[model samples]
Target: MRTTTIPVAAAAAILALTLAGCSGGGDDTTGGAGARTPAPPTSAPVTSAAPTPSASSTGGRASAHTEAELTGVFQRIQFRPAEFTTTDAMLDSVYPGLTVSDASCLAPFGVGWDTSDDAGTVVFGTSNDRSMTAVVASTGETAAATDLVEDARSALTRCADGSALFSMQGKPIETTVETAEPSLTGTDEAIGWRVRGTVGGNAFTLVGHTARVGGDVVALVGWDPTSNTTNVPLATQMFVDAL
Candidate 1:
């Protein structure tokens, strides 16, 4: 998909670049699901600043949720937090769905591409190139949510060593993805992964996560220019908690 780099902007902070949760613990990827870490903070979270909602979240959005409902979720995220951006900007300032260089990898990475009657999408961003894309959708008899989460984890794990993920402005990005383990509890199932590489030669890191909260599947993705400061464990914890 047109996996271009997200539009540049700024915010208080972006998503967690570390394996540690917001409590600032450790980045352990080898542990089992039961071996979770601490919880992240709840304020000034991912894509914190209010971003203009996209069409899929508005007229094209599912359920056509009321303004009040939207505001409440926004408030939760603002007070809460993650990081990453794709052009449609969540799944980097990249897309409502991600367009990848290799077509086979599309389904798992393109988190927001599914705009079924059961789903609604919204993207959040700030002034400093920070962003998070969230999608809330219902599961069906076909086990949509379960498949989605599982497939994403599988795809990320397969691509962990590095591959051509997408192209931005014709620049191919060879990304090395590492799965993340968030400490926040309360969800039937969860999946997360972070991407590291350069876009047009500018280093960047992005993280995305999804969980099954009852019948609804919620997903969040974050992106930021890679920096020594971006790997803060506390922010990563804070970012995962909001999910």
Candidate 2:
């Protein structure tokens, strides 16, 4: 992993730095083929935009899903399903699946999961950085977190020839949708968007959702939070599976 680290404190209006799905709401870990046991909120805080809007939903899905719900789903996976986690070795092993290349990876902040239930955003992030915000969506879209992954795929379709979507401060990141083979799932004609963003004041590469994973879309995103971009993309991609 590179040693580039972006300070979250310098980011503008960071909504919530807490890991996704570990809210104080009680353990919401759900098991397979059985009723889910609601555990106490795992010390993680839910990041919400200020001036909270009167909950209005766009899609039929309930307003934003709680982090606990997202986490429960991750915990239910056959292996360590977390997109990002406190366990470094576990993160290193699982995150590679989400990557466009081994050279890129998810940055670290606090290893936890997150959900934008109100905005229909479900994310499991490694760190908190302004440039790290990956998805933007309507609350209705979030209800179908899987669909949001499809939406991301659709958006990528717009950028042919390996174009990527980027988020920049005081500017809009340009993107051109493109098609690529998912190196992990061995799916041809898989949908993808190549993403680029500024890190440590320089252009950096980020990629996500190159293939469909068990009816879900996954993306890997990264920045210069650490000089190494090894696992950031894998972490973001893990969020898609966790959703």
Candidate 3:
């Protein structure tokens, strides 16, 4: 077992804000067990853009995915339309250290969807215990998306050693990251990892899955304060098919 420290204030802020899911809705259609169909590339050519550290906007080059297209990707994963919401501020807070430069071929944008309850922010579908947040981006160069996935894999591996620590407000929050080989197949590349830790005496487990399809990369993070298990593989496959 390894331990890492992470700042819980900023990270926990996003995790603590528990929003309810919409009610009276049925489950969305799920993909079949057969081979997955890869998502197509952006219609427009990707242009070069400089990375800017702005919480309110995606400073990198714009993705071909419109707000609707991005939302559609999540919807294919069984999330209702109403549950999907923009999360620029949350992304800025959690991944401040992740660089998003044109040179790096990584341009990240994210959305948050509520799986449980329905009275909080944006309501979508029914209330349950599972909630998911995803960051999808475009990589201009060939194999760039694969490189991004590997980078995340490496970072998670380091954190699993129990040596990573982040400061939350002024308190020391201990952290740990665990990863496993995914059983799902058919994607160009994919990886899954689990993070468990305590912030201000509150325990949380975050499950994440990252996969590359064509020139795009999708990173899904699911969290539940009470459980460490998540259906990330199913969600990841759905995302791939939706692409």
Candidate 4:
């Protein structure tokens, strides 16, 4: 894993959504029979939402992207004049090989990197192995904190590594991904699941909590990784509850 320095001004970026946040697998390359594609491990077939569209599908907007989406932007979202903050040790704990060159940035997301620096209102940080990098804002950061919580709920709706997941509201829309009948099920059916992933070659887990946040439907978008594939119930609550 190689490490490198990322500039502050160049590192800051404002994603479409309003808040902050932060998966994994082995290198087994065995294929299934004559096919080169490795057969997915037969983990017990965990049933959650069957993958169906929620009530929000009726021309409704999402409150925000789920945790998975926000986490997906860990390396993609950066804030100018870095404002929010996190410690180096915290980051290292989450991402083993993280290194910070700025020393003036902070990771507003619940997770952090090995090295972090703050520059004015802007924050900067990089993974130890340099596989990921990100920056966030501390200005008006508290206001976005609520948005962050909502994102977390959305994350659960999409994928919870440990606990079972189901929608808490509307029925999950069914969609075909490969040969699997993965349905998006109702929000009432989408809940639970552990959050797990890797950063800088280290394993990390995030679980618990379905925080409520204030933000419009437009405020939350493109925040979770599972958005494209599944709907997040918690996120829907935040969006609908947003004032």
- Per-residue lDDT of model 3, residues 128-154, tens digit only: 223455665544332444556766666
Candidate No. with top TM-score: 3
Worst 10 residues of 4 by lDDT: 173-182
Model 4 per-residue lDDT at 65: 38
C-alpha lDDT (0 to 100) for residue 136 of candidate 2: 21
Judging by TM-score, tell me the better candidate of 1 and 3: 3
Taking all chains together, the TM-score of candidate 1 against the true structure is: 0.51
What's the lDDT of the predicted structure labeled candidate 3? 0.42
Candidates' C-alpha lDDT: 0.42, 0.32, 0.42, 0.26
Model 2, range 1-243, lDDT digits (tens) per residue?
122222222211122322233222222132221123333434233221122122222334334445465444334221122433333332332232222221111221111213323323343423322123232222333234345444455444443233133233334344333344443322212343344444335555554433322222333443334422333333333343333
Q: Ranking by TM-score, best first?
A: 3, 1, 2, 4
Error of 4 at 18 (Å): 36
Which regions of candidate 2 fall more than 4 Å away from where they truly are? Answer: 1-67, 72-146, 159-179, 185-192, 196-202, 210-220, 225-229, 236-243
Give the residue spans of candidate 1 off by over 4 A: 1-71, 79-99, 102-110, 117-130, 140-142, 225-243
- Roughly what TM-score does model 2 have, to 2 decimal places? 0.34
* TM-score list, all predictions: 0.51, 0.34, 0.52, 0.20
lDDT of 2 at 122: 41
